[model samples]
Target: MADENAEETYDNFEKQAADQAANLVEQLLAALPEPETRNKPDGGLNPVEAARRQPAPQPGFDGTIASFAVNHDVLVPGLYLSRQDGDIATYDLRLVKPNQGGYFSMAAGHSLEHLLATWLRSSAYGRQVVYVGPMGCRTGFYILLRGMKQAAAVSLIREALQAAAAYNGAVPGTASTAECGHVAEHDPAGARQLAETAAALLKDWTAADLVYPA
Candidate 1:
């Protein structure tokens, strides 16, 4: 009876959390500005005028990328807080050690991206997840979360990776060309292997380990 009661309480908590997250998202969407309505005197946008009004492009990838300043030579395989903007926090899920030749293959990274995103979006904190994608460096991936505690984010990543590692079915969002642009490049086996490796590496990870090694 106690176990049953505990399960019931936990279910209620999860439901409430989901409902609150949904309400917040609805409010944010409602607050977003409507599509640009500016038009030229002729009732059509002028490409030349629009181009002139745009901000000048930076030399290369902006002058202030926090990740670029990170010393990759000393960076190890672990989770690190990349940056924070307003309510969102970007996390670096480093799967492979930096400057090592053990980088994930293209197929492996692509497959893992699909698997990780799918599993994460279906987790308890799914509503907090802003985005999930592979890093250009091929050493790891990035996950953006909104208003999440560091401990909860760490827990979410660990559990999601464990789930991905054990996953044995059709990779989500890769059923056909209609679903994915590069459908032929997925490798479930390779993705699972990567997930397994990452899961083990983060088995004991905690919020305290979130900082980049100095």
Candidate 2:
């Protein structure tokens, strides 16, 4: 009974810490100055114009990315926060490790993109789903949502990936599709195999999966 009490105390302490972290972020964001609404008259900023005007966060890095801060050698699959603007949050839904020869094959990634994007945009949570697409590095996808919680983002991606894992329909963009241009390159079987592997990894996510390793 003492051990059970200890475990309950530990759980409550953990929840308090998580709540404190969330409150800190809320305070920090509230302290920032208002964004420059360069192109609007009603004090509203167009997201596209704001994105175009903001200075690159890491100009000297490759592609002006802050990714240099990450040690790709130890990178693992998980939903890492990429950027947040107001309520929109973009997450790196990484499924493969980089610089370790675990990158996705072209056929598999393409099919996975089609399947996951379709599922997310049409799912019950579609109202919060903004965009889903493959990354240039061929490692995984970028999923954008309309909220800022890491736990909720991870849950949504896991559900989407699970759907993709069990998908057996005619892969969109395949030759069988009436509007497909590169139909011969599609691989539904390869896509399902990779999604199953990715879904397994996501099932056992840790805090390390929510942030980039430095």
Candidate 3:
């Protein structure tokens, strides 16, 4: 009886996730500058190819811009160039699809952001780790690294992700009132799984994945 109840609960969770994903798909399709295609020209976009997507400057908002709205349909989970100025490069480190791939609960995204930011700031390439934060969309993160090119940036992120995947210790700085906002919402275990999933997707990082849909 207990097992049956647990199975039913799991089914409910899956249903909820599926329903949420479907709703998001509708929203993304409506917002995209380009229409969603049933098939990608090729199998699909590979690697950091998405790196070339730069947000066009908005009229106002103090020079703030939006990401390439057209390519939202093609954006996949991986490293992509967000923008660059001099030695500073911002990357869209997508973990979930814009609307359909996977969903990160708010608590999960928050914990992952905290842990990832902490890890990146302390890694061997820590000097280049400019910033690591979650996107408003909650599908992934925006990572800014200084003094690194695309390939180097990918390597740095891959290593950091591997670390996050293997992580088993307490999430640093997530429990202190003075240290974080909503610190009690941390979910280190969930965060680790997200990291592991992303790392697997990038294990064989290749040049093929470096080009966005043409």
The TM-scores of all predictions, comma-separated, are 0.71, 0.64, 0.66
The alpha-carbon root-mean-square deviation between model 2 and the true structure, to one decimal in Å, is 20.1
Ranking by TM-score: 1, 3, 2
RMSD of each: 20.9, 20.1, 26.1
Candidate 1 per-residue lDDT over residues 1-214, each given as its tens digit: 9999999999999999999999999999999977565664433446787677778986895486788899899999999999999989999999888878888988888989998888888888889999999888889999999999999999899898999999999989899999998999988999999999999999999999999999
Alpha-carbon RMSD, candidate 1: 20.9
CA-lDDT, candidates in order: 0.90, 0.79, 0.79
Which residue segments of model 1 deviate by more than 4 Å? 1-62
* Clash pairs for candidate 2: 175-183
Give the TM-score comparing model 2 with the true structure, all chains together. Answer: 0.64
Cα RMSD (Å) between model 3 and the true structure? 26.1
Task: For candidate 2, write residues 25-122 as lDDT tens digits.
Answer: 99999999997767665456567866777777764635645555567788887678877779998888787888778688888888898888888878
Question: Model 2 residue 18 lDDT?
Answer: 100
Best by lDDT: 1
Q: What lDDT is obtained when candidate 2 is compared to the true structure?
A: 0.79
What TM-score does candidate 1 reach? 0.71
